[model samples]
Target: MDVTPLSLARVHFLASLGFFALFLAIALALAWVLLLFKIQARRTGAPGWTAAYRLWVRLFALAFVLALAACVPLLFQLGALWPILMERVGNVLGPLLGFAVVTVFVLKSCFLGVMLFGQRRVSDLAHTLSVGMVAAGLLLATFWLAAMVSWTHAPAGAVLVDGRYVLLDWVEAVFNPAMPWLFASLVLASALTGAFLLVGVSAWQALQRPPADAERMAFRVGLRLAGVALALQVAAATGAAQWIAQAQPAKAAAAAGYWHGGETARWVLFGWPDAAGQRNRAEMALGRLPDWWLGRSAEGGQLGLDAYSGMLPPVAATFWSFRIMVLAGLAMIVLAGLTLLRLHRRRLDPAGLPRAWLHGLSAGTWLGGLALLAGWGYMELGRQPYAVYATVTVTEAAGDIPAGLLAGSLAAHLALYGLLFAAFVRMTYHAARYGVVPVRKAGARP
Candidate 1:
């Protein structure tokens, strides 16, 4: 495939999305650890745990800083491609887009500064306030990014009058197309990831030489919370699927392996999507199945869907991604629920329940990761054929990027990120295993 600046931008955008997910995962994991430490301190009356909790909180804050930094370059990259995007959008929404971009950069920089230096001040109240500010800034940054994404697919709140742009429907544009399901899916995934980390860490703690009761309790509570989060994830995925079916029929059908005619396509259990063929040919065909069983077109007849209405396809890709997300979500919920149940019954022995629960949580974490990736793949790939907005064809967007540069950059990023990931794992393991509470010297701050 030929590479253009636009194609490069698209590749970078996808890479940023991957980095965003990984960073979010790391942040969630850190947050979970911090919360667990705080809870343990409160429950066990351990003053040392308070210090540990604070340290972890600082670490979590640092991760957020790193995440923001990692995302900043993407904004610049997007800005470079803004000219193309503006041309595609007919230049009407340019100012709004510019405003959003500027606001995000400013907010990100402010937060980064605060996170980097605010802790140096010894005042507890000042430190707390600074942290809160950072959090609020991050939220604003997220909103700005989300608004940009939402606007691209569904432009609203603006009008073109005789060649000039007029901002008439700001509110409409802000909430255009109503992407509640997509937003909910992202938030739910974050929560589920956090809960899964909590459970996994607690279980690992419980498996240490002498079983820690605090760790066991944490594990149980984490399991319960994870179950709840997973249930919410399932519901969110279902809603998202329904939304796609209503808004983007072709993508949804692709995801569900559904195509025209009464042949009744069956969902693939596992297989790579054949983009050229416009189908997800299963490694092992399950044969034609009823639409009702697939929770789509049970009554048949296009389900009265207008596939062209949405920017994405309403069929195959969207449908399959939703199913994958739901299945993984449900599995997590079930496993977590069972772990919670066993704990409640006092049958969660260290050797049996804790180890089993850890394994289950790990599986759920990996599955959730896969589901998230698949969902994103569906969103991007299903929107293919048109690379820049739905109106701009992929061929048109391909600009001046060399194949070698793109390939080399991707390889470098993968290697660097892989090393960082391994280091993170090692740090986490060491912290969990050998970093127990240390004794404070006399007259020192406890």
Candidate 2:
């Protein structure tokens, strides 16, 4: 297979994005979890709660560091691989990116230290306030970033003139129609990912040794959070899907493997999308329920990918990515439900739950992260051939660079990310296995 510079650049950017996304999801989700832990610690004055807060705060720090590190490449890649894109949408994207950066720097610089190390130096109220601030900052920063991405897809509040985007309405541009759905999806996905991280880590710790109070608390909290978030995510995803179908029917059709679009209620649950044939091989579908639930998008028109010739996204990639994401989400919900049921029955303690079940929960450590990645792939791949949705073609925006150089950089990035990920896993394992060690006074003996 031959690869062009554009393809290499795309893959390199995607690798950077994927790493940043995984860590960012962890940081976003854990920020709230850390706040909850601190609140519980303050309310109950329990050592277990404090211990949980202490232990998880370290993990949060690691995730934040990696997230920040991973983001650096993406920023540079915009100029390095797609300078034309910046030239085109710079006016619209500049403010959003600036706000997100400022939010992170201000919030993290001011309160992150307090949340991390000043807990002992400051009053309980002050420390709790710091944690809350950090969480709020992460959410705010995410909003700006999500807004930037959504604008690229929907291009609202802006008009394209002379090959450039000119902002008309800041408010509409900031809160574009796609922005809210994207924000909601991202936030919920992060929360769900964090919830499962808690569940998986706690379960692993329990299996390795006698369950501690902190471990039990983490397990129960994770289970409940996962259950609630999963349900909310399902609803949000359904609504988001409908929105996408209405807004970008071609994308929706490719993702769902819809070949012939008409006034039909049939929903393809699974299929192999054959782009050449313009049909789904071995299709499985719900005849009427999907249309009832999601509504038939009349705007989608009678033709599917056929109508979007020369502009349609890769069909199989979109179709399979969507299915993978759905499968992972459903699996998570089932696991959470069953685990909660078992706990409610009081047949076994957190550690005493069936070994198979515990193993399954433990194995789910990366499931949320992977599922979120798939969801991203489905969304992004569906918007293929466009650097700024319909306005700019990716080929037009791609930078002039040798294929060899791009390929070399891609390889280097993959290696570096792999090493970083391995380090994170190893460090996390040691931290969870041994537990947090309390700080002692000066000259105190171990």
Candidate 3:
């Protein structure tokens, strides 16, 4: 099992991406929670909502800090592991990234501090506006990242000029073919991630000995939030799936396990992708769904591996990531449906929903993260063997990549991120347990 420099670069790059995604999801989730808290306070005027608002403000600040810290390394990885990407198109992407730095790093970070430190200095209305702005910044950041990554998968805005890739149209680069679909999916995913965190934490709070009523309110809010988000996720998932099917058919073929040539391709739950054979070694096939679902009809739009001639990305990674993402999605839909049913039946009252239901949500809290990670892996891995689709192969663009340095960097990152994760979990647990900041000097104008 010899690991080449290419493999080392890939592993380190993937690790960096995974670590960054986790923290980013946390930050986005916390931002959404703040916004939800603001809306809840406006609607109910309840002390419970106020307490929830204060509690979430503390958690969001912690998440924002960790996410920013994790991102710093990823910027380094781009140059260290994928120098080709930076050298070739740095100019084109530099401005796009600048937008996120300003919107998210500067604007979001400033407002976040105002919310955390300026509590007494700012009015309640001003505090709410601050949190809302933070949420907006998160959304903008998500969009910018998604669009940039989507461009790598299916580049649209640049051309190879002389020996370098040059930016021809900023519009085309920013609004790549895969950008809108990916952006839609990620937006729903952020909400889903937030809902799950709320459900997990609030459910734990509700199960405390003697279970406070405010905790019960938070639990109900969590479930309802998840339900509403799940409904929207269905629409988003559909668009994303269709976009993948059409824009990247080779990836879609791998995903659906449709290796054999046919108009009606069978969907596989799991299998070994035999790239050399151009087929799945062992498959559990569910027929025609990918074709019909994508509105491709009987003619499956050349889903077989044989359809493509050039270098194809690894099939197994694409296949399994897609499978895992879809399974996670199904699990979320079930949870959401059950939540909605309870609401409609009037069973979700202040007396507190069943212990079993709370426990169920707590148990499944990681599903949103699983779905998001798997979907990201599917999207990214399916474009592999190339740093940029059709333009740069991993080998061609590596640019004297240092295997030893990458391995060292990967180890250091894992250690640092592990510490960060432990700290975050501990901080959040204490925050949830203690429950909410005190509403200080409510009548003061200053």
Candidate 4:
């Protein structure tokens, strides 16, 4: 297989998007967690709650800054790599992206300063509201971005004239069938990402020193919130899958590594897709699981990759990424549930817990983040061969860029992203261990 400029550009775009997305998700989650901490601080007037708020605000600020910085490359890549995408869907995508940008700018310029710096100058209620508004802005911005992506997968309220897509109804297009499920799943995933980070950091802090009130509170809340979010994710993921299956059956079939359509589809436990032979080379699957899961029978219809020969996505990539995502999600659910149960049995005593359990929790901090990245990989790769589903092929949208130029830029992006991630981990670890810095000395007068 030849490595074309288009492939290199896609790799570069994916790398940039992944880096931006992880920080974006973390920032969104941390904003809400900060709000909770602020509310608790004001209500109880406890130093512990205040300490927690101060500690997490630093992480939130770090995430927000990185997310913002990482987004610049993606914005440029849209024009550099797939310039025709805008020409084709600019009527619909331009406004959606503009809305997202406006929300982000307004919140960052207005409320972020208040949330981070105005805690001392503003009233308690005013500061709390700022934090809440920041979270709302993040959420609103996420919805618009998600709406644009979802519309590409299932282009609703739009019609093609000659080649360009023209919008028909705003409500139907923005709130398409796939938008709700994708947005809901993303929010739940973000919550899990933040919750696990909180749990892991709090647990690590306990292991380093005796548990403080702030650590105990953070640990308990993180555990409970993770459990609740995982519970809700079950339905959100299922709904998303069912909708995708209906909207893009070829992508769904590729995820399952199904080559031949049948009423009773196999739920692949493990498999290697052989596109050349049009079958799975070393497949291991539960043949009846799909029937049970989807409520299908012999009379029901199922589509597979065979139905869309030249239009199929990369089978192995989709299949394995989906599997990784599901496996990661299940592992997190089990870990969270088990930890919660043990804590409950021990009467919520961290002192009674084994060090090994804490180590496991610490090591599992990235599981939620891993699941999120893998799920995104599956979603994006599953839409392959086309930039906008069946409407426009990627090759059609790809700009006339030289392969050498794309390769050099891709390398630079990877190097920078690696350094950024390393700095984030190192600084975060240092802060979690040492605690937040005070604005003034303990004996200083206001």
- lDDT values for all models: 0.56, 0.84, 0.74, 0.86
Off by over 4 Å in 4: 292-300, 345-349, 440-446
* TM-score-better candidate, 1 vs 4: 4
Kindly list the per-residue Cα lDDT of model 2 for residues 1-446, writing each as its tens digit: 68888878877887788888889999999999989988998889888888888788999999999998887899999888999999899999998999999999998789999998887687889989999999999999889989998998889998988988899999999988898899999998898889899999998998898888888887877888898899899889888988887777777777767666564536788778887788889988886535423324346334467667888887898889888998889889888888888887663358769778889999998778878888888888888888788889889999999998888888999999999999988888899998887844345576
lDDT of 4 by residue, 36-142 (tens): 98889888988888788888899999999999998889999998899999999999999999999999999999999999898778778998999999999999988
- Candidate 1, 240: how far from true, in Å? 1.5
What TM-score fits each model?
0.75, 0.94, 0.91, 0.95
Per-candidate total of colliding backbone pairs: 25, 0, 0, 0
Better of 1 and 2 by TM-score: 2
Give me the candidate number with maximum lDDT.
Answer: 4
Those runs of model 1 whose alpha carbons end farther than 4 Å from true positions after fitting are 1-12, 28-52, 79-83, 86-137, 159-167, 211-221, 271-300, 303-327, 347-356, 362-367, 387-389, 392-395, 436-446
Count: clashes, candidate 1:
25
User: For candidate 1, lDDT tens digit of each residue in 308-346?
Assistant: 333334344455666676676667767777776666666
Clashing residue pairs in candidate 2 (N, C-alpha, C atoms within 3 angstroms): none
In model 3, which residue pairs have backbone atoms overlapping below 3 Å?
none
Q: On a 0 to 100 scale, what is the lDDT of residue 281 in model 1?
A: 59
Compare the candidates by TM-score and give the number of the best one.
4
Misplaced by over 4 Å in model 2 are: 262-270, 282-289, 292-302, 345-349, 440-446
Global lDDT of model 4: 0.86
For model 3, state the Cα shift of residue 332 in Å.
1.2
